[model samples]
Target: MTELLLVATGLRKSYGQTAALDNADFSIRPGEVVAVMGPSGSGKSTLLHCLAGIVRPDGGQVRYRHRELSEMSDAERSALRRDEFGFVFQFGQLVPELTCVENVALPLRLNGVKRKEAERRATEWLDRLEVTEVSAKRPGEVSGGQGQRVAVARALVTGPRVVFADEPTGALDSLNGERVMELLTAAARDTRAAVVLVTHEARVAAYSDREVVVRDGRARDLEHAA
Candidate 1:
């Protein structure tokens, strides 16, 4: 059997009286793309947060590469997120004051990389994501597609082991969304980075190797079920 990069078992989370995740289970292998699909308010985002160690579950456990995520200290988890994981959100949340290249290099800069070296590598990723022309442009100066591509570039610039993308294309048109997915998934696969994609769109989910459906705070791995 292939080794698992991340695994969540019997997970549970709550907000006030509301349960966001109840007994949800999920797993992903290295270099694999897994889409968590469900409607709005279905807890898909919550599950991704839990898996990425952004949120601590009320019960159960999340293991990554044989290490328990819940067992790590806050600083350790912060460091892990900084060095090992990447994220892309629905709005292409690039810093408004920074140019596209600067945005991409932000992660490396945060990791103590020199400015020149960081932007150089960031430029490379921008080129790979087909947004080289916008390297000097600010987020507001670019089109939605371009900005999302830049976001994708930023998520990958650090060569993260795993990427947590939540509705990465929700703000784009179909054509732009498709292009973003193509570039994002292709880049992740090339880097051997596992992707945890959360989306309600089946077309987007089709880009994944497997799908986990989240409904009412529970998860069902379709591939495993069949």
Candidate 2:
């Protein structure tokens, strides 16, 4: 069996009277791609945020390598997020002023890598994602697909253990979305990183090795649901 890299047990969260997660249990193995699918407001994004340590659950625990995230200090959790996780969002979220290579190198720079070395590594990822031609272009200067490819390159440049993507291809057309999923999964696989993908589209979820469906603040394995 593959080693488990992340686990969430009996997670619970709420915003006022609305529950975002209710006793949710989920796990991810190293190098596995797991998709979270559900209707909007069903708490899929909340689950992803909890798993990524961006938001602490009101109850239960999120463990990464046996260390409970809820027990960590804010600074410790922040460091863990920066060192161990990557993220891709629907809008790509690349800096408007930074060129493609610069955007990709930002994470490495945050981790204390020298600019020259970071750019070199960033260029390699850009080439891998087939966005090398856009290396000198700013985010606003490129097509949506090209910008997204650059975002993927950025997310993986730091060699994180996990990638948490929320509707990563939501803003793209079918053809572009397909291409992004292919590259994202391929890159994560190549780097031996687990991916927790949150998407509403079945076509996007199909890229994952396993699927979990969220409904009414609960999550269940798709296979188990059948």
Candidate 3:
């Protein structure tokens, strides 16, 4: 049986009278990539935020491995977010002061791994992503695509069961965006991580195992490759 990495149902969020999410239900199975598609103001970002536990829903439950994310204490949720879930935002939020390898290793070090071990593992993954050439370069020294590739490495370095990405390629040109998405799809498959990618482009969604259309604050049943 496929394991469920995330489960959410009846997720609702509103700002005064504006409903950002209305009766949203989501389930992500292990090692699967689920793409969310919606036009602007469709609450795609809100849905990703809620699943990431960065935002609390006005009404709903979020489960990660059967543990109620909504019920966890702030510290617990933070730990869960840090350890079990990884995230890549539209911008490559790498620390400009840190080298690529250092940025990738920062999370592991923060989670209490030894510096030597973290760097070793970070280097290994960077090598896999073909970014080891710039492992010593600061974010400012690298190209935008390379920076995003590093972000992908950082997100997966800890082996999180699921990774949340919002508009991951929105800042890039078509070629670069396609390359970044390729790395994401390949890395997720290689690591067995469930990836939840939020994008407006149908082409980007095509790389996912399934596409879930979110509109008017709700989602349609997932569509798979024909």
TM-score of each: 0.97, 0.96, 0.95
lDDT of 2 by residue, 93-171 (tens): 9999899999999999999999999999999999999889999989999999999999998889999999999999999
Model 1 misplacement above 4 A: 222-226
Model 3 lDDT vs. the true structure? Answer: 0.90
Per-residue lDDT of 12 in model 1 = 97
Q: List model 1 lDDT by residue over 48-79, tens digit each.
A: 99999999999989999999999999999999
Q: Flag regions of model 2 displaced more than 4 Å.
A: 222-226
| Cα error, candidate 1, residue 31 (Å) | 0.6
Q: Can you list the residue pairs that collide in candidate 3?
A: none
- lDDT agreement with native, every candidate: 0.94, 0.92, 0.90
Best by TM-score: 1
Candidate 1 at 225: error in angstroms?
A: 7.2
Q: Would you list the rank order by lDDT, best first?
A: 1, 2, 3
Candidate 3 C-alpha lDDT tens digits along 99-216:
9999999999999999999999999989877789999999999988888889999999999999999999988888888988988889899889999999999888988998778899
> What is the alpha-carbon lDDT of model 1 when measured against the actual structure?
0.94
